[model samples]
Target chain A: MERGGVTVRVLGIDPGLTRCGIGVVEGIVGRPLTLVDVNVLRTSASVPIAQRLVTIERGIDAWLDEYSPDAVAVERVFARSDSSTIMGTAQASGIALVAAARRGLPVATYTPSEVKAAVSGSGRADKAQVGAMVTRILRLDAPPKPADAADALALAVTHVWRGGARARIDAAVAAGRTP
Target chain B: MERGGVTVRVLGIDPGLTRCGIGVVEGIVGRPLTLVDVNVLRTSASVPIAQRLVTIERGIDAWLDEYSPDAVAVERVFARSDSSTIMGTAQASGIALVAAARRGLPVATYTPSEVKAAVSGSGRADKAQVGAMVTRILRLDAPPKPADAADALALAVTHVWRGGARARIDAAVAAGRTP
Candidate 1:
């Protein structure tokens, strides 16, 4: 799937205390995206919260150093009825934002539905559908193992397709021109 | 308030996105506590969440470098009906944990009730009562401005009283001895 030029690389993160999924994708809008890497960072439940956060920070830093993506996208955490789970997720997401911002990388956040809609054209798409779309788009023989990993790849694809177009429009507007 | 010979310095943090309160206190339990410092770090709501977190990290790092506290105490964030406020608070608290853990400082978390009980001898103490107790305990001319600052001071006092005792107990147990 090829279109215009201006290739952009994006690192997307699905933050969690137990398993933080990270994926990198490279491509321009409307083009077949290449999966640079995909992995999940895990921290044990027995570990102290402070140490768990440090582990996530180190993992994100390593990915940033290795991939050096143009932008970072993190799943926006929402408060749920389960306060404990939401707290950990929100905290983990915060570390992702801090890591990307520390390196002066543009950071964007997308809701789960946003990523689902961008990939499958349906905000209400289920996980299996989203994963199927991601596998098809990346031309992978199989979907990424673990739901978090596939979710992260979906986030990167969403950003590359939506964020890329938004960035272009913003640049054109700043330059006093019409896109 | 001088029952013990050991004097431990503690830096307590009340984390929030709009205003994070930081305070340092030095003294042994049952003795008059000295307020080393107390201040609030403020970030504008207009700022992006990622940049706001960076601002907090820098502020905490500066405090850690300046005080060299033996330990850190952070107020535990609780989930409330106000999901948005809690999300920011949880994120900010994560930064505090990371900054202290990175420095290898022992970190403890205390709930609001614990802080209030430690200072006012009542877990259900109101804000004004807690502030008055903090002012009187520290022998300050006035209560710390803004509730966050006073809350931070209370957290430090709580750690100095409870955490110090717990550490001694753990050490004694590790040594197979009695305190």
Candidate 2:
């Protein structure tokens, strides 16, 4: 699951009840990243709610088993968005987190703005811009369709760049030093 | 997990990130419910968020394995409550749902008002009234501690009373008729 001497394999998840996207990437921070796989798992609305959650869990488990990434990256859900869609998103995120945690993988979360800024150099970058950047960074022939896949890849790239071992150690030290 | 000739074992969940409550009840409609078990599973905020989710998942799995309930009942999450607590609650609910779904058990969600009404005959009943009714219904010496346990038991009672086999059939028919 390694690319170079200092490579890190990352699995990023853009969680959604209807379409949960997963992307795996491998590379060091400064080097060009390789796209291992990209997929958008979907659960139909017609299924019972519990069964839908089961579908999401199975999809996530399959990805984790297949990729065995060094770290799992997830989109941080904000409670401020008081919408039904956000509730489903939060639930999907929880399922993904549990899957990664059960495997004892490090899990990091980044906000949407952080993901966009990391991928496109602008927090305010639109979807198309982020897609372009993801395609360029992964050296893909074209942007991943449906946007969710691209967002997942962006999340992986962001984690690999911003939340590596050195960054986590620094964060821990900063928290300790603050107290 | 059986009580009488007509036995219904229900595992009710009051989902929360920090203090998720689980109560198992065995009984029949129009009969005094038996309290099988009650517990609160806690995950502290100081721990890593992913680990917290893993703890929750493990707690739920343990309950399901031990209780072997016929059905799982959960408190439904509302998006209107724009608070951090609701976010964690939703996440925990998701984990519980997935655990039950993986076991092929039926999952039902009751709103707070519905639970109160089913337990106390009043939708606007306060926590004390609900707790008192829970004690009376189960013939307990005293109310379960921390309030969450009572709420979980109430949810299980509500599901047994309102969402039995007939109600589930009706729901399926309604869903099928919807289009």
User: lDDT tens digits, residues A56-150, model 2?
Assistant: 88988888888889999999888876486888888889988888988988888899999999999999999999999999999999999879999
lDDT for each residue of candidate 1 in A85-154, tens digit (9 for 90 to 100): 8888888998999999888888888999899999999999998998899999999999997989999999
Per-residue alpha-carbon lDDT of model 1 for B119-157, expressed as tens digits? 899999999999999999999999998999999999999
Going through the candidates in order, their DockQ values are: 0.76, 0.76
Question: Each model's TM-score, in the order given?
Answer: 0.92, 0.93
Kindly report which residue stretches of model 1 are placed more than 4 angstroms away from their true locations once superposed: A1-3, A167-179, B1-3, B168-179
lDDT of each: 0.90, 0.88
Categorize the docking of model 1.
medium
Top-lDDT candidate index: 1
| Segments of candidate 2 deviating more than 4 angstroms | A1-5, A165-167, A170-179, B1-5, B165-167, B174-179
Q: In model 2 chain B, which range of ten residues has the least summed lDDT?
A: B170-179
